[model samples]
Every structure is written in C-alpha cells, then in structure tokens.
Target: MAQARRELAERLREGGSESAALEARVLMEAVAGERDPDPFGRLDPDATARLEAFAARRLSGEPVFRIIGEREFWGLPFALSKATLEPRPDSETLVEAALDCIGDRRQEPFSVLDLGTGTGCLLISVLSECRAATGLGVDLSPDACETAQHNAVVNSVSERVSFVQGSWTTALDRRFDLILSNPPYIPTAEIATLDVSVRDHDPMLALDGGADGLAPYRIFARTLPDVLAPQGIVVLEIGAGQEQDVIALMTQGGFAWRGSRRDLGGHPRALIFGYALK
Candidate 1:
C-alpha cells in the first residue's frame, strides 16, 4: 500500500500537483477506509483496485477533493456535490473573520445569511460553532441548494440552518445580524487562465465574475444593506488584489468599511464591514 501511495504521488508530482504527497495520503485513506492505519496491512485486492482507479483520475487532473467528494473546512468534514464548489482553505479566512467579528455573540441566537452559498460551508460551519445561531443559505442553483441542505444535515446543523434557491437577497425579506459570501470573483477573461482543477472542473457560473471580477461585489453593494440589521456585520471573500476596489464599492453601497483579514499567503482575502451601530 505504501508503494502504491508513492507511485500515485509520483504520477501526481509529474502532473504538476503541488500537494502530490498529501493528495496521495488522502486518496489512500479514502480507499483504505481507515484513519492512519498501517497502509500495507490495510490493503485488500478490492481496495488496491480502487486506489489504482483513483490514482488514474488524479493523474488526469481531477482535484483530489473532487475525486474524494469531500473537503475539510474549519475542522469539519464537508461532502462536495457536483454543483457545489470545494471548500478551500482561503475561504476559511472569511469564516475566521466572521467568528472574530462575532466573538461575544457565539451563544446568542444571532441570525446569519450566506449569499451564493455553495455547500453551505460558511453558514453551516459558523452555526456549528455558534450553537444558538440560526442561518439561511442562499444560492441561485437548485442543485447547490440541495447539496448544501444535505451538508447541513450531515453536519447536524439542519436544525439551525435552512437553504433556499433564489437570487441574492430576493428570496427573503428579513434582516440578519451577519451576512457572509464567497461569491464568484474571477474575471470572465481570466477564468480560462485558472488551473485545470478550477477552469474545467469548477462550474463557470461559480467562477466567472463578469468583465472585471467585481460584478457580484457591485450587486452586494447594492442589495445587502437593505437586509442588514443595525450594527450588522458583513464578511466577504475577495479575490487577491481586490481589497481597495471592493472596499470602495461597498462604501459606495452604504456599508461602513471595517477592515480585512489576510490569508496564509499574505493576500487580503476576507473583507469585514458592518452597518452603523445602533
């Protein structure tokens, strides 16, 4: 099994996978159906065959997360569906920023709204931490909404979370204490330049952000303020180098700019702002 893992990693490395070793381990674990067991002892003929097939898919440029159909965000395992975007480490920046902004209100029944919610990762993860919170996740794609609902169930957050398929801020007419989103931000022209894992595997509707990658932000700036409660906080995942432009756009749309958080790569990834204090 170890030899198989190494062979798979080598093939991935040759294919330019940055985390070949890590992906190999994750894939093997899935095939092994065990956590950190003796890989050599864990292998059966059937498992070995599955590993080879998984390795072949990986070599062909399918992301390990997609092949495994799962991802980890904020220490929780989230299952991925074809309609949902994989929960990425960078998106965790938004979660951390939201948690920090809501530090003292963790036990309160603070309401949350997640826009363009794919996999419902943002809202569901937050609800997992904020035990008393209730959340609503919104997305235009029906399939994504269903997947997110399923994720909520698997995470045991269904009791506190609900999902709906509708345009941003249109399906509901209520105020929320917090709003979060990791909306599509890649520029239309730049979508073609993304890696195969994103350009081809990820849905174009989830990747394209109009001509300048600011279209969704523009929409947020226009619509979000109407549904935010007094002192309500807003956390958004921004594309790299989009800090000032996004801040300016939100400011024009009437949100008070608070600040932003940087990701591990030192990029301004999560922007934070809020309504005027009550």
Candidate 2:
C-alpha cells in the first residue's frame, strides 16, 4: 500500500495535480473501503485495478468526488449523477443561512422548497438539521430528481422530503416558509474558461447561466414571491462578485436583501432575502 501510494502520488504530481499526495491517500482509502485504511494492508487485484481507473479519471480532469460518484455536503453523503451537480462546500452557506433563519422554528413543522435541487443536498441537509422540517426538491432533470430522492432516503430524510421534476416553482401549488437554490450563475462565455474539472465534468445544464449568468436569478425573482409564504425567507448561492447583481434582480421582484454570507474564501457567496412588503 505504501509503494502504491508513492507511485500514484508521483504520477498525479507529474500530471499537474496540486494536491497529489492528499488525493492519492483519498483514492487509496476509497479503494480499500475504509476511511482509515491499514498502510501495510495489501490491495487485491481488483482493488488495484479500480484504484488505477480512479486515478486515471482524476488525471483526466474529473473531480475526486465525481469519480467516486458521491460527495459530502453539510457532513452528509449525497450521490451524484450526470444530470446533477456535485454538492460543493461553498454551497453549504445556503444551508447555514437557511438554518439560521429557521432558528426557533426548527422544531416546528417547517416547510422548505429547494429549487434546482440537483442531488437534493440543500433541502436534505436542512431537513436533517431541522428534525421536524419537511421539504420539496424540484429540478428540471428527471435523473437529478431521481438521484436526489435516492440521496434523501440514504440520508434518512426521505420520509420528510420529496423530489419532483419541474421548472422552478411552477409546479408548486402551495407556499413554503423557506426556499433555497444554488442556481447556475456562470455566464455562458465563462463556462469554457472554467477549470477542466468543472467545465468537462459538471453538466452544462448545471453550469451555464445564460449569456449574462444571472438568468436563473431573474426567474427566481419574478416567480419566487408567489411560492413563498408571508415573512418567509429565501437563501440563494451566488457566484463570486454576484451579490449586488442578484440583489438588484430580486429587489425588482419585490424582495429585499437581508444580508450575505461569505464562503471559506471570504467571497460573498450566499444572499439572503425577504419580501420587501413584509
């Protein structure tokens, strides 16, 4: 195992991986089916082959989580599919903001709606933290909706959560106390310029944000009001430097910017909003 790690690390380093040693360790542990594998343990022939395949995929610009087919969000595991975006740590700001807004109401029968649900990470994570909360995750892709549903079950939140294939909030006939979304906020032109791991592995539907990259926010501004209950809160994950642009769009739709939360990088990544009239 030590020799295999050294060899994999060297190959990844030569392939331009910045965190070759760490990635090598993770990949090794994954193949060994444990978080803490015995460094002296021997890999079976099949495990060795799988490790090689995973390393090759990573070297080809696939994200480690993408190659593993799952990612941890808010400390919960979420399965990924071609139609779904891998749950990212940056997006966890939305969950934190949502839970903060739901504070005292956490134990109540809170209702949540996650737009562009993807792996249902946002809604599921919120539901997991707020034990009595129920949530609905909506996405345009049937495969994404299916994958999200499976993730909810895996997270033990299926009974409190549901997923649907639909556009934004159009299919909803009721209002929700909280709404969350990590929409595609990347400009169409910028998609090609993104890191190969993102441009090549993430679904275009989950990355392209139209010509200006704010199309989804525009739609949410115009439609979210109708689906949000009075005094309800909406938390959105925005790209770096998108705070004001998104705030302006939502403001035009009768929503007021409440505040913003920064990601680990200190970039304003989560925008909080509430009905202007309320």
Candidate 3:
C-alpha cells in the first residue's frame, strides 16, 4: 500500500496535479478493506488493475467524473456517462434563482420543464428544493435520457421527475408552471478553445450553441410560449456574456426578464424570465 501510494504521488506530481495522491489513496482504500471490503482481505489484483486504468485515462485527458461515471452537484452524487454533460457548479445558480422565483411552498403542486437536461442535475436539484414540484427533463440524446433517469432515482426524486428523449419541448405535451434550462450557450466557434476537460471529455451537444450561442434560447423562446402555463416562469443558465441576448430573445417571445442571478464568481450566470402578463 505504501509503495503504491508513493508511485501514485510521483505520477500526480509529474502531471501537475495535487489531488492525485488523495484520489489514489481513496481508490486504494476502496480496493482494500478500509473503505469497502473485497473478496480478498487485501486489495484485489483486478481492482488494482481497474484503478490503474482509471488513472491512466485521467492522465490521458479524460475527466475524473467520466472515468468514475459520477459527479457531485448540490452536495448529491449524480451518475454521469459520455451521453450527458458533467454537472457544473455554475449551473447551481439556476436552482437558486428558480427557488427564489417559485417562492414559498404551495398547497398545490407545480410542474417544471427542464430543457436539455444533462444528468438531471438542474431538474433534480429543483425538485429537491420544492417539495410540491414535479419535473420533466428533456434531452435529445437517448443516453442522456437514461442518465437523467438514473440521476432522478439516485436523488430519490424518480417519482417526481421524468426523463424524455427529444429535442427541446418536442416531446412535452403538458404545460409547466416553471421551465429551466442550462442549454448549450457556447458559440460553436469557441468550443475548440475550451479546456481539455470540457472540450475533450464532455458531450459536444451540451456545449455547442450553434452560431451565436443563442440558438437554443431562440428555440426555447419560440417554443416556450406554447408549453408554459399562464404566469409561469422560465429560468435559464446563460454564458458569461449572454445575459442581454437571452433577455432580448425572451422579450421578443413575450416573456419579460424577472432578474439575473450571478454565480459565486459574480459572473452573470442565470436569467429568470416570466410571462409578461405576470
């Protein structure tokens, strides 16, 4: 165990990362009896081989989340796959803004629609917050839909959330009291410049925003009017520089900007728009 830790530490140092040693330790413990018991008292050779494979993948530019098939968001563990984008902390602003807009608990349950749902993080977080809320998460990828379903189950909200495979609101036939999305808002041209963790490992559909990084918003603006119940709210996660453009599209679609929420880093990250009549 000591020898393996030392080797992993040296590998991490060469990779310019400090967390490698801790990860290796945890993996080693997991393989051994400390974290979880194995068939053998000591670490299983097969498990150690798997750990080496994961470490090699991580070293070769794969994200740790992808290698582990899970990510932590809102303090909950969410299962992830190549089909969906990894959950990011910045998107938490969507949950906060949604909670603020939805207000105190209601006697009647309200429905939420999540477009481009990836790993069901946003929808599941909102359902976790609003006890009276049921949500439907939509994604174009079938794999993403499965991943979202797995997340809903893991978060203990499967009964309150449904995952559907389709683009935007195409598969949604019911109206929702609130809609939220962390759609692809990065301009297509800028995708190549993203960090290797995102550019190489994350799903392209979750990152590419077409031309101006506003295509999804445009589609949402055009489609939301049909599915949003009267007086409903739409909360969207926007690119660092896309607040105004998203607001403009929402305005053109007859939705009015309620407010914008900044992320922990103070970048304008979430935009809340409500029906103009509201």
Candidate 4:
C-alpha cells in the first residue's frame, strides 16, 4: 500500500499537484471505501480499478473533493451536486462569524436566509448549530438547490431547512433574522489564474463575480438588506483584498458595516452588515 501511495504521489507531483501526498491519501481511502490502516494491502479487483481511475482523474487536474463527491465543512460532511461549489476550509470562517454574530440567538427560533446557497453549507451549518432556527436556502441552479436539500437531510436539519431555486432573495417574501451568503467573488480575470482544481471544476456560476469581483456584492448590497429583519445581520464571504471595497459598497447600499472575519490565513474573508433602518 505504501508503494502504491508513493507511486500515486509521484504521479500527482509530476502533474503540478501541490498537495500530492494529501490528495493521494484521500483518493486511496475513497477508493478503498473506508479507512484502511494498511492502505497498500491487497485490494479487490473492483477497488484496484477504482483507485486507478481516481488517480488518473487527479493526475488530470481534477480536485480530490470532486472525485470523492463530498467535503467536510463546519465539521459536518456535505454532499456535492453537479452544480455545487465544493465547500472550502476558508468558508468555515463565515460559519464561525455567523455563529458569533448570532450568539444569543443560537437557541432561539430565529430565521435564516442563505443567498447563493451552493451545497447549502452556510445555511445547513448555521442551522445545525441553531436547533430551533428555520432556514431557506436559495440558489440560481435547481440542481444546486436539490443538493442543498439532500445536505439538509444528511445533517438531520431538513425539517427546519428548506431549499429554493431562484436568484438571491427573490423567491421568498419573508425577512430573516440572519442572512448568510458565500457568493461568487472571483473577478473575471482572476478566474483564469485560479488553480486548476478550482478554475476547471467549480461551476462558473458559483464563481465569476464580474470585472472587479464586486458585482455580486453590488447585487447583494442592493437586495439583501430588504430581506433582513429589524436588527438582523448579514455575513458574506469575500475574496482576498476585497474588505474595504465590500465595506464601501455595503455602506453605499444603505447597510452599516458591522465588522469582519478572517480565515485561517488571516485574510479578511467575511464582511458583516446590517440594515441602516431607514
């Protein structure tokens, strides 16, 4: 097994994979269908075939997450859809921020709305922490919406969570006490420069935040506040170096920039906002 992993790792490294060892381990475990202490041990023909296929896909620049079909976020496993954007560790920062902002409301029967809810990670994660909270997750892609629904079931929150297919906040007439979004924030030019794992596999609809990476924020600034309940706050994931610009856009859109949150790398990755109560 060690030998197989080494060979796979060599293949991945030669293919420009920065996380070759990690990717190799992930693929081996996935193909073996469980955690095997001795990964190099003999495998059934079926498992061996699966491992080769998985390795080939990885060598071609496909993400291990895409090949594995799920990612863990907020300490919970979320299934991916054809149109779903694989959840990232950085995205967990937004979940932490939302939980902090809604500290006292965690146990309350509050409401949440997640715009551009891809795998429903944001809404489902937040809802999991808030036992009594109900949420509506909206996305432009119906396929993504369905995945979110399944994710809700997987996390045991489906009873309190609902999925919708539509643009941000358009399908619902009600306001929520908490709004969360990890919208597309990569600029058009930046998209091409992204690592192959992202640029090639992630659905473009979940990326492409327009020329400046602030296009969705502009739409968010204009639309989100209207769906927020009195005193409710919004938590949005943003691209690196977009902190001030996003704050400015929200301010101009009639929202008060409450605060921000940083990811593991200390990048200002999430912006908090609230309606100005005009």
Candidate 5:
C-alpha cells in the first residue's frame, strides 16, 4: 500500500496535480473500498487495475469526486452522474442561509421545492435537518433525477423526498414553504474560459446560464412567486458579482430581497427573498 501510494503520488505530481499526495491517498482508499486502508496491505490484481484506470482519468482532468462517483455535501453523501453538477462546498452557504431563514419553522411540517435539483443535495440536506419537512427535487435531466433519487435513499431521506425530471418548477402544482435553487450561473461565453477541471468535467447544462448568465434568474423571477407559500422564503446560490442583478430580477417578480450570506471564501453566495407584500 505504501508503494502504491508513493508511485501514484509521483505520477500525479508529474502530471501537474497540485494536491498529488492527497489525491493519491484518496484514490488508493477508493480502490480498496475503505477509508484509510491498511498501509501494509497489498492491492489485488483487480484493485491495481482499477487504480491505474482511475489514475489515468484523474490525469485527464476528471475531478476526484467524479471518478469516485460521489461527493459529500452538508456532511451527507450524494451520488453524481454525467448530467448532474458535483455539489461544491460553496453551495453549502445556500443550505445554511435557508435553514437560518427557516429558523423557528424548522420543526414545522414545511414543504421544500428545489429547482434544478441536480444531486438533490440542497433539498435532502434541508430535509435532514428539518425532520418534519418533505421535499421535491426537480431537474431537467432524467439521469440527474435518477441519481438524486438514489442519493436520497443513501441518505435515508427517501421517505421524505421525491425526484422528478422537469424544467425548473414546471412540474409543480403546489406552493412550498421554502424554495431553493443553485442554478447554472456561468455566462455562456465564460464557460470555455473556466478551469479544465470544471469546463471539461461538469455537465454543461448545469453550468451555462445563457448569454449574460442571468437567464435562470429571469426564469426564477417570473415563476418562483407562483410556487412560494404566503410566508415562504427563497434562497438561491449566485455567482460572484451576481447579487445585485439577481436581486433586481427577483424584485421585478414581486420578491423583496431579504439579505445575503457569504461563503467561506467571503463571496456573496446566497441570496434570500420573500414576497414584497408579506
């Protein structure tokens, strides 16, 4: 095991991986099907083959989570698919802000609607905390819906959640106490300029936000109010420098800006909103 780790780290280092050693350790454990595997143990032929393949994929710019087919968000495991975006730590800001907004209502039987749900991380995480809350996750990709459903089951929240393939809130007929979304916010042209890890690996449908990157926000502005309960709150993840634009769009839709939350990096990442009259 020590030999394999050293060799993989060396290869990844040569391939320009900044965190080669950590990647090596993670990949090794993944191949062994355990966390922190025995350092003295040797890999079987199958494990060795799998490690080599995984190494090559990593060298080709696939993210570690993509290779492993899962990622941890809000301390819960969520499976990923070709059609879904890998839930990032920045997105946790949305969950935190949403929960903060829900505050005293956390114990209530609130309903949550997560649009562009992807891996269902936001909805599932929220439901995990609000035991009495039920959620519906909506994604445009069938594969994403299936993957999210599986994640809900893995996290033991399947009974409280349902996944559907649809565009935004089109499939919904009822209002929700909370609505969350981390829609694609990258401008169409800027996508090509993103780092290879993101540009090459994440699904484009989960990244592109049309010409100005505010297309999804526009859709939300036009449709969100209809699905928000009288006292409902909406928390959305926005790209850098997008707070004002998104707030304006939501305001045009009759949503009043509540406030915003910053991610660990201190970027304005989560925007909160509620109906203007309420």
Candidate 6:
C-alpha cells in the first residue's frame, strides 16, 4: 500500500496534475497522524476515498479554492462559498487606490462603502490598513453577505466592517468618504466565450456587464454621487477598453476624472473618479 501510494503521487505529478499529489499528501497526513508523512505510509480507507472524490472534482475543472473552500487575498485567508465570486489579485488595485486616496487622513474617522463586496476581501483589507476606518459592504446576494460577514470575523475586523444585502447604494443612508467597486463588467455576450475556468466556475451575476459591458459603470456613476461625501473618491475596476466609455459616464453623472491606473500588464484596469464639484 505504501509503495502504491508513492507511485500514485508520482503519476499524478507526471500527468500535469500537481495539485493531486498535494491533495493526496494532505489527506494521507490527516489520516495517518503524520504532518509530514514517512515513506507515503498507509492512508485511512475513508481518507483515501475522500481524496479520490476531491481529485475527480479538481480534474473536472473545479477551482482549488472552491474545493478547499478558502482562498488567500491580500495576505489574508478568506472563507469562500458558491455565493461569492472568487477574489482575484487584480482587485487589489482597488484597495491600493483607496488607501492612496485616503493618505494622511487617518485623523478623521472615515466610512467606506464597497459595492458588490464579495467575501469582504476588499473592505476587510482596507479596514485592516486604516484602523480608524469603518466599512459597509453591500451585495445583492444574501449568501454573499453572509460570506462577507464570516470573512470580516475571520480577519478580526467584524466590529469595523458590516455586510448588507442590496442592489447598488439604495440602502445607504449616509454619505461615505470612499466608495469602491469591482462590479460585473464583462459583456453579456462575451461571458460564454471566456475560458472554461471563468465561464464555468464564476457566478454570472458577477460577470455579466450588460449588452455594452458598461451598464454597471453607468449605474454606479449615477447612484454613487448621491452617497459619496463631498470631494470623496470612487474607484472602479473596469473591463479592458471600457475606460473611455466609463469616464464618459462618470462625466455625465458629474464626477471628475482623477486619473486612471493600470494593472501589472500596463492595461488600464482601474479608474479613479472624484465626487462632483459642489
């Protein structure tokens, strides 16, 4: 059994399914009470069965994060469920832009509003940086709200971050110092054409950006101004080539162009806008 397990692990690696080996190792360790296994010793029968099931799912294109039910974002591990979209590294740009906009303003207790806050990763990360900050994360899905709340507690920022379920900023009663969003910006028609990992796994509500792929931007531009404090900033993650159109929508809705930022590949990935002039 020991030698057979070693052969299985090596074959999985050779088949270009490296995660299978790691998953098997973890399961065997749990079953055998060895943090680091010796000679790939015997795995509990039940544990081996579970590993096989997980491997089947993984091999069929399920994300590791989904299978494991956790993902690391901004150096924090967040619990994930089907209700929330998987947090991606690109969204970190929104966090960075928000912090930069709040520079040296720590004296004032600022309120942050995160639209479409999935898993609370963005809001939690920001609140972690600005101890004086309090955040409200809103999502349309109740499951997402629950997931976000769980993440807040996990990150030890439950007192500073609150999760609400709603569409847009309709439920917000007070103006916020900062409002940021990485809403669905993928064009409706283009969604099906995306890679299998994205198309099959990610939630459609988080991906469909409407016919023009700029609908959410238009809505945010219209509604955020009302909820944003005077001179406050709003940063949005945009789809590729949608920057100009998004800026136009912001202008029409009375926002000022504060400038744009690019992702690691130099594409215009995030847009920063200032609240309308009084």
Top-lDDT structure, candidate number: 5
Task: State the weakest 10-residue window (summed lDDT) of model 2.
Answer: 63-72
List the candidate 1 regions with Cα displacement exceeding 4 Å. 276-278
**lDDT of all predictions:** 0.89, 0.92, 0.84, 0.89, 0.94, 0.82
Q: What total of clashing residue pairs does each candidate reach?
A: 0, 0, 0, 1, 0, 0
C-alpha RMSD in Å of predicted model 1 compared with the true structure: 1.5
**Native-referenced Cα lDDT, model 4:** 0.89
Model 5 lDDT tens row, 1-278: 99999999999999999999999998998999999999999999999999999999999999988999989999999998899999999999999999899888888898999999999999999999999999999999999999999999999999999998899988678999999999999999999999898999899999999999999999999999789999899999999899999999999999999999999999999999999984
Candidate 1 structure quality by residue, lDDT tens digits, 146-167 = 9999889989999988999998
Q: Candidate 2's residue-wise lDDT over 89-150, tens digit each? A: 88898889888888888899989999999999999999998899899999999999999999
For each candidate, what TM-score against the reference?
0.96, 0.98, 0.90, 0.95, 0.98, 0.87
In candidate 4, how many Å is residue 268 off?
A: 0.3
Query: What is candidate 6's CA lDDT for residue 142?
Result: 94
Best of the two (1, 3) by TM-score:
1
Superposition-based RMSD of candidate 6 using all C-alpha atoms, in angstroms: 3.2
lDDT of 3 by residue, 73-135 (tens): 998889888888898888888888888887775435999899989898999988887777898
Query: How accurate locally is residue 203 in candidate 4, as Cα lDDT from 0 to 100?
Result: 96
Q: What TM-score does candidate 2 reach? A: 0.98
Model 5 per-residue lDDT at 74: 99
TM-score of 1: 0.96
After superposition, candidate 5 runs with Cα above 4 Å error: none
Worst 10 residues of 5 by lDDT: 164-173
User: lDDT tens digits, residues 90-175, model 4?
Assistant: 99998899999988878989999999999999999998899999999889999999999999999999999898899887757888
